[model samples]
Target: MRSRLPRLLTPLVRAALSKRVLPRVAFSGAMSAQILGNRARSITTYTEGSDLPRVRPHVWPAPSKDIMAARDFIRESAASPKNILIVPDREPDGMASGTIVSLVLQLLGKPESEIRIHFTAAGFTIFNPLERARLSRVCQKENVSHVIVLGQGARASWSLLEKSIETKALIINDQHSDRFLENTVAVSASRDPPSTTSSLLTYIVCSELHPEARETTGWLALLGIFGDLGARASLEPPYPQELKDFKKKYTSTHLRDLVTLLNASRRTPECGTRDAWEILQYTPQTNPAPTPKSIMKGEANAELRERLKDAKTRVNAEVRRCSKMPPRFSKDRKVAIIFMDSPYLVHPLVATRWSNYFDPNLTKLVLAANTGYAEGKVSFSCRAVSGRARKGDKGGPKEYETESWDINVISILREYLAKDSLLEEQARGEFTNGYKRATGGSVPLDVWMLFLEKGLEITPRKGDFPQKHALDYIQD
Candidate 1:
């Protein structure tokens, strides 16, 4: 069912494409009614030459003191002789946001040798003990002076890591609901609609660092938005003005294709992320930059092309196998949980698929967990559907315009996991830290098992389970 979603919604997307605009996709079945009934009014998405409701006029807010400080810090650090280490999660949004900072520094006269980038592996964050060890090595060897984190969580200070890795200044750019490091310079999009993503958020601040940044980095910002949000970026809107100008600059197909390619870069746990950074970079003089198609067909990128093909095969297979496992509900029916064990990174895809299957009012949350993604740890993804479409609504899914249930998912996870006796002896690092609705952790498998026993009802695997439900997808 997860693998079939794009096919189910493709026509609506094509209809949206025909008009050279983002799709005003309508969920036409019971999904049209329940998952998003008009519970709360919010920003809207529009279609040209059609009666699709227009997005609310967004009043741009002034940059905050944190953003100004971050802006000033980057300018000052970019000129220093000491090296700067950039830490970003491997997701498309993180990569895009990291890319934006890299470009800004280069423009600000920061040399290539002075900058270092490390893409945290699948199911990991910089705060992870293993990741900290690796980053600390880089810092010690390079004489690092500062650390700039984009779209990932962190502690307020670097005191936890080896003393040598702590830089003179620490800056973070994020929009997640997790408890960010206190007493730090940071830029946050929490005040914006939940939709404002990392790359878009980073561009908002980095544009302040240099004059040419706005002109040179629009494409990257768009890529970042599409990368993180995927088709949802098109299906939902009141897209922040941060992305308004860039949206019109590129064709939706081109942007979508670019997103597919960019996301493919780090889909697998063993896949190296630097290639993605290299692939996403804006070539100095190429007119309009290298395209996904050109790069795929280009002789120089055969390895990347093969990498994408392999990732697509692995992800689609995992999506079909795990999406049908069936979910167990928390007694209150507020959370629907499914368990999977896959080496490939496909939990989010499976979770998003299941999120569309349950009744919204009954099951407000969907969590898909992969117990085999990493050793001794499980990675999970969480998603929510807003509310049912209201009376006489026909243009789009009510979810695109309705706000999610008021209880934040991250808050719930933190509330429970932080105090659970199951994790008292363990580090419990980044347990409840993640973007607003997409919450999960690379936690000890036992921690997840404990959460299941306490928070959800568990059932044994069916002996005659439909594990081969996706055998045919191998040929797809």
Candidate 2:
């Protein structure tokens, strides 16, 4: 018999049908599933979702109107394009590549002959001369006419594209506030408050594109969104609800696992944009067969999923090692800093994992540094523990102040960077957001350690970032 509860008494009836009465029902499992389904529907149906509480890793809120504006921008941009090249920063980042894949899928209807991709180096790092040469040559060989930059395009890339002179159009679809030109087609949640690049891009493409394109591309955008905003999104109202709806359509765990796998695959020193692109190509499809070598060859191995699992195990082991060691406490005793002697490639990942292991009751902030003596630089990653009690939280948090401030760890590191003359105060955009609470970047290793040992009172040279860091010194 079908189970039916009276509509008027639904709330009271469900409440009364508690654990005591649950097992007594003939269709207990079905009843439980139905209740859960109803609850899920209610979460999306809540009137004017702004009344809903914010959750953490700090989702910056964007208004629904702005989300629609960004959507319209992308839809209009994608409507017409020929010989398109997806230019993302060459850094080994999952979100960066996720954006690339999202766009590729949006343009999937276009002939393969028309779509091409190039990954550019990040802004802070000096581009490899050979890689720059390769990029120029790739653009010419592919006869790229329209370029869609996924992240903030490095100045070096912009200059190279200009020099090539064949590109007639450029589109900036990034999350950052960087506006290369007044006409750059970039819509940023950061630039446009409360919307992340991933959220904006996902909303735009899904709402505008064909159903087939939306089905293929929508999940990749969510992966990118999780990569930037963490599992709990901080996007504006309808977007967050949109994310929840998307998650419900599939196994959320698979999306999370794909994000982890992308990070693990990109963790190695050998990985770059090409590997990221290959990984992106493989991520959207659900094939029972082994990962095809044709999809991802060379650094993009077919066994990457297994390899990522192994990497997580190793990273977890290292976190345990760091936990056993006595951390360097800040003078206030609020921050715990750990310095790792691990290889350059593993530092950020190790630091990120280690940050998750902190005793929140004891430490408010966690900083992890991996130094490269040979490269003469130290890469640092910092985080704020979510469990730490905030100053005003004695009674409890207010509606907006749901999570702790992201701790301004980026600004803290930047102060030392500026004090040492390695970076100017305005150059804070160099670091990538692995998570909202997590930020890290390479500073002059020798100069940073001096400030770490001595106070910022020490003066260093102006513009002395080493052309190559310790990561460059390592041989395969």
Candidate 3:
């Protein structure tokens, strides 16, 4: 084989002659042969295709049953002749009622003359300043003969009663079942004093959500339902087929917008009632509608933010300063509660900020002022936040219970912890015994000074808290 090989093949022949080399050459040749043989087979196996159908277009489902029910309630309320009243659980409840009432009235073809609305407010003997102003404006614009008050308690002394005797009154007791309806009948049946003849009727409406009467006399029933329930989940039947589509399109968006507008108004006192009234009148088709921008840009919001900021700054500074001063812990272990007599005047934002500064760990007992009457007793908002309870427990990190006072003085002293341990102990015992006795408790002049000094130290921030003032985040 070597003698026959050409010059170029000589190396190959020599490699083959070596045992190790011959083995490698044979293995490489086998690999090359296999690769060449499989080339066609690999191509055939790799290539494949199949036909698939196109996806169908997506379709949106119909409006939910809950939405339809809400729409029907709205439409039915609009068609009624009786003046509708909208009341919510708090301040926004008033605004929601106003907006819903106005919209429904317009839908029902009633002029401003036919509908009258009022919201509750503070003051022992007179109308709340805001309520008074609203009443004055309403009286000036329309010959308002009927006023509907919503929510649980209806104070008899509010200044709205002083208006021209011609105006009739309707009180809707939202808390108790059948109470409003019964009261309405009683008021209508009772003879008005001989002096007031212009007021013709005062009516209270309640609801079983009668479908037969809904389209025709539905407004009255819806008014009662809305007034009593506020924005609670509905238990009524789903809406009819006719209204389902429209509700699907509008209900959620509208509610979100309404909530946003209300929160804006609430945070900004400068926004005032006029701005609120304008927002209520806004419609999607209107030129100057209440968009999120419009609501935030309104003057009232700006003013409120400025005031709130000032209040916060002042209060925070005072809290820091007082915290540095020696803790005036009384001789007894019982912590003295210090707070303002007018909690309403002391904004919640400021109160919360001050509370944090005073006790970052939330170990101290801080009583904030609150306004409301319960069980025929006036109470303050007493809040306690501590690591005492777990998240799911009944008495968790924060506790809110009403502390009633018999008289303003006792309330103020108790709120300030102005009384010494002995006196405070006595006051506590008296409060436990009866609300009437607690009302009579008195604070010494020195204790009153201490309370006043503590309050005076708290300063209002120059600008509102950024979180509350920003209207973009507020829902309608």
Candidate 4:
């Protein structure tokens, strides 16, 4: 029976192969053993349960013309003495902006010395004195005469605008949502015009790409889509043929990594800004492939990675310590609040690690950090979580119940003040007896408090507030 089956089906199989319409076949165990004859071992058959449809050809659209346009835009921006601000909603998004900024600067022949990059906090409240001082110092050191605000609502702070009337400022309105755009435009129009004669320009760069453009040029558009759209699965309009092709060739992870590297430079000052500038300069061009050895040997990559590793370790240690302590809300359960100082760009990792150990259902993660410099004020990042919501099945949880492992450290420190008498005394000038403090003595405290109130909104429950002078550590 087996031998006869092959004889009967040979002609049909060959005809189907020629027409590219081979019919699906199924075979049971040991029934038609001789059907394949001498080639039996080479020919395998699928059963009904098999998933043959999973096989797919790699199809990507060709590179688009818009890439070139994007490159040209960057080149033009870089050439002019303008400060470029790239703001993404998250660290990865911010990193993508950094990459775009770096590429544009390089293309415009502007050296690292002439470029300045800034990121806005998650909530857009810049009120930290330390951050303010740092921005002031950077402005002075770089002799930056212009500012470009990227992301949805980033704009030159009134203070920064007032400092030097000669500074030029531009805003790149990448937030495509009409609602967000309207809010941003209104905010900009309401602010007082800068004392400087430099002009402010706003541009709308969407996700769709234009064909005939270079890959480097199209990054911002793609990035805007990925970042602002919350990594939606569907592609957006203005979909150039080339962009579709690029998407097929590159996985989302690849694009994400590129953005992360760029952001790492800005988030980690210890890594040195020049290193980020270098990575951005090399990434956009069709340059030699970057090797692990090359990245390790590169001063910027090395410094950035080292600092990141150290910061991660520190955060892990803090989380562990907090976990061991009795829960502030419940004694028998696990309670933790992870805080990140500045936008260290490692909040997600830290949060994930903490969530794994403690029941994400029982654990509360808070992410906080600095966003950008606004009118001599430092912006902050803050988020909170609740144990009950973690265990719930709701698809989208409430804001207060959601955890932000990246809660700004500045904000956490401020919350500590609200709950601890020692911190409040220090803030109220009761700690030191009649002695004059330095210029920014309580600046840190103020920054921390603002982060807690504005960023996290973690108000104490009834009787949760600390008692007056309850803490014995209060110094005179």
Candidate 5:
């Protein structure tokens, strides 16, 4: 009966794609029309038009005290002969933005030999312990004076970095820091929405740095936005209007393709930094202007594509498998819990990819877990649909936008996980409410299952979780 439901809901799914999916696209006009074209008529993609969104005017923001101080510090540090290490996370956004920052320093008359990059693998300290150790050694050997960390920062890397350089390093990140360091100058706008690390850097370079930087690095900053928030057409609260404003100024498809190439460049965790550096310097006369097609045509990119294709295939197969398994119905049949063990799977994509399956007609309290990192610890992603009816005139068990579900998700997880033992307990956002789901670290799969089973035996509760602003890292 459960398997047959897909056959029965086929028409409904089709209708939802037309009525629901089309309007929610991030942009409109020819590009949107192409992507959403004839969904109501035919499902074929529009292959002709430019996949890029139309370009709009870039809005430059006024530089704040922190950005100004950062520029002043870089300028002052470059005046002397001491080397500067630019530590970038080994990901597309970090690579692209870090490269741009490197270029900016050069334009300010900083010598290439004086500038070096220590790329963190997988963009975290925990994952790149070896890399962190190596960077510390290099900083000491090379007589490095100052360090600039770009993109989402690694909390674990900070202490090591502090000891490596004589002067405290500057961190430009959008993600929340694990804890405040005593001497380090850290810039973060986690409370603000839609501002990627790259975008913030762009604003600083264009508005405060040399005039030439505005012309050369504007596009790179735009690419950074796509690299971090590519799948999103529009973002929710705290995300600045500048993101939507910036999209109007460029071809989104081109940007999206560029992001894909950047992501592909760093696909291999071991040599991601080297790959990104080569890709960054791949350009001819002008600054790097790589097209997705051009990158894909390369032998390396071809191999990367093959790997990605294989991963996608496996992931799709798993989604199907999860879909077929019926949700565990409780004694009262009010809650649903799903546990998926996908080792070595892609990060974050699984959540967005499988979210559509949380149909309102199916279940209300949905909790799902997937294996995260190789350490046996689990990453939990959640979704909640309004199941019980309200005092409405009609429309039974309909889905409506509410913070209740996200709040509840955090509440439950906090209740289950022992605070003393749990690792990486903080949400990616304020209360993890932005994505209409709460996603964060939980205990290992066995521990989570035990908690889930226990929760099922008790009555469902709300607001059981307390909000926490600052938390530190935990071993997975």
Candidate 6:
């Protein structure tokens, strides 16, 4: 009943024992404790786990006011006598959020026919006029009575979306909500660096419908969490109980691999979000639900592996080609612009790749602009230079507030657009869009050129950024 770790154990042996890393028997269990004196006690399975205090099942704090409001809205809407239109962002987190909504609705007895999933066009957030018009039309004919917006756009965009669509009730769930709208809820892992993903927030709200809501869709929730938060979801604390439960069932690496494969469905040139959703959806909503393993191993679907390979292959080639482009910083050394003409949607990928190499203090953001990604539009992706808040830095993302330590690159772009007289007249799609911290814009040729020539105060040399000026912001 008593045990003590021998100080004589080497670090490697200690780590092996602590992590249970020594194969089937576990390092600690493989060795029986030896008693040396009257004070010493012998215990088999000398696990570091045994030395630690027992941890209780994590109980979440009572849902916040916003969470309660979202819960109420979903509860009321579930029994609504009309169609509910679900508009998900066109990426992994969005898809996972939409799927969670669909499953929870069915759990609340809402029929499948009443739930409709709408995918916005690529390179378009809800802020895009084209997508807004599409949503307005979808809400027309008085058929869609309830609306749930998931996994994209900040609260401002969500506010505008609510006014744009004429639904009886609307719920906005996002990771970047500055303030809660009428029916908006925001969540994150910890308040400082990473936010609770949109999909996980949806699961938390849906749990009010039934306790099984969390049990059934915990794995699905991690899809969105990992898709948005990346590996930080597993690393960060204030960890969600649902996420903890999922880790019990699957390895962090395996979940990550699953997220990559599923994300590939949408990121490829073809954009197979629907295909991804089909494989990811938890059918029948029962205890023996399908898991990430089923999708990875291609259970009942051999084509999954092939499709994943095709998507990854195309993305890898494009990323490799565009990642070679070097960054050009602004006069103040705040913004680092890297321009490449790629036909694939690799701007975000290359921007993120470049972010890994940046100095968090010197480079505020890395903007990867792809002129060839969209026809006649210069699509750009923005990434914050990696850094964490120190003491007294979490007040705001502005230079003065955070010492530009954790820059709000989104605000910088938005401020430029708002102050510049040239961009004031530009339409929504022709300028800035996306989230608060992770924002980017699609600029037409004229605007793109003006931005390149005058905005950053950098002259685009043919050697530095070939097509930026040569093609007049168009990539031949």
Q: What are the RMSDs of all candidates, in order?
A: 11.0, 12.0, 27.8, 18.2, 13.7, 12.8
* Candidate 2, 1-476: lDDT as tens digits: 11343663366346444521211122222233344322222212123556654222221333345446544544443444655566654432334443534444455444544567665443233233455466657767776655555544333134434354555333334334433433334444432223345434544534454544554555555666666556655433434355556676644566565656556544444443354455555333444322222222334455644555565566556556644544566554556666655442465555555455455545565776655322455666777655433346576532222233435555555554565344443234444343345666666554454555443342222222223453343333
| lDDT for 15 (candidate 3) | 44
The TM-scores of all predictions, comma-separated, are: 0.73, 0.60, 0.37, 0.43, 0.59, 0.73
> Ten residues in a row with the worst lDDT in model 4?
191-200
lDDT of 6 by residue, 15-125 (tens): 444543321121211131111111111122344757644422222222366677777777777889888888777667777788888888888888887887777777676
Which of the two candidates, 1 or 2, achieves a greater TM-score against the reference? Answer: 1
Better of 5 and 6 by lDDT: 6
Clashes of each: 6, 9, 29, 40, 15, 3
Per-candidate local distance difference test:
0.62, 0.47, 0.32, 0.37, 0.49, 0.63
In model 6, the runs with Cα more than 4 Å from the true position are 1-63, 155-166, 178-194, 234-237, 387-405, 411-437, 461-476
How far is 107's C-alpha from truth in model 6 (Å)?
A: 0.7
- Ranking 2 against 5 by TM-score, winner: 2
* Cα lDDT tens digits for candidate 4, 195-239: 000001111132222222245545444443443333333442213
Q: By how many angstroms RMSD does model 6 differ from the true structure?
A: 12.8
Error of 1 at 189 (Å): 2.7
Regions more than 4 Å wrong, model 4? 1-90, 105-143, 151-157, 173-214, 219-244, 256-277, 283-286, 289-476
Off by over 4 Å in 3: 1-90, 113-141, 155-166, 173-261, 264-271, 283-346, 350-366, 369-381, 384-476
Q: Model 2 misses residue 108 by how many Å?
A: 6.8
Deviation from native of the Cα of residue 213 in model 4, angstroms: 5.6
lDDT of 5 by residue, 1-476 (tens): 44674585465456546543322222212233333323332222233576644432211122256566777777776675788887776556677667677767777777777887776544234224466567677788888888777764434333644353575477676554445344666665432122345554634543356666655555566677667655553433223334455566555776676566455434332334465455554322243454444554554355555554444455556556644434454444444544444443333444444344444444444555544333445555565543333435575444433323223454544444433232214322222332323344344444443454454443222211111110112111
Tens-place lDDT per residue, model 3, 1-476, is 23442664455444433411221111121222222221111111112363433332111111133224433444554554544444322334444444444544454455655555544443221123455466546645555544454332323343444444334434322211222222221121111111100010111121122332223222222222232222232322221222233234334344443443444443332323444444444432345434333444453356544443444455445444333322223223122233322222233333333333333232343333222111112232222222233234664344323221112222443544433554444334222211111121123323323332443222222121112322232234
Off by over 4 Å in 2: 1-82, 89-109, 120-134, 152-183, 190-206, 234-236, 240-242, 272-276, 279-304, 307-326, 330-335, 356-364, 372-376, 388-403, 414-436, 453-476
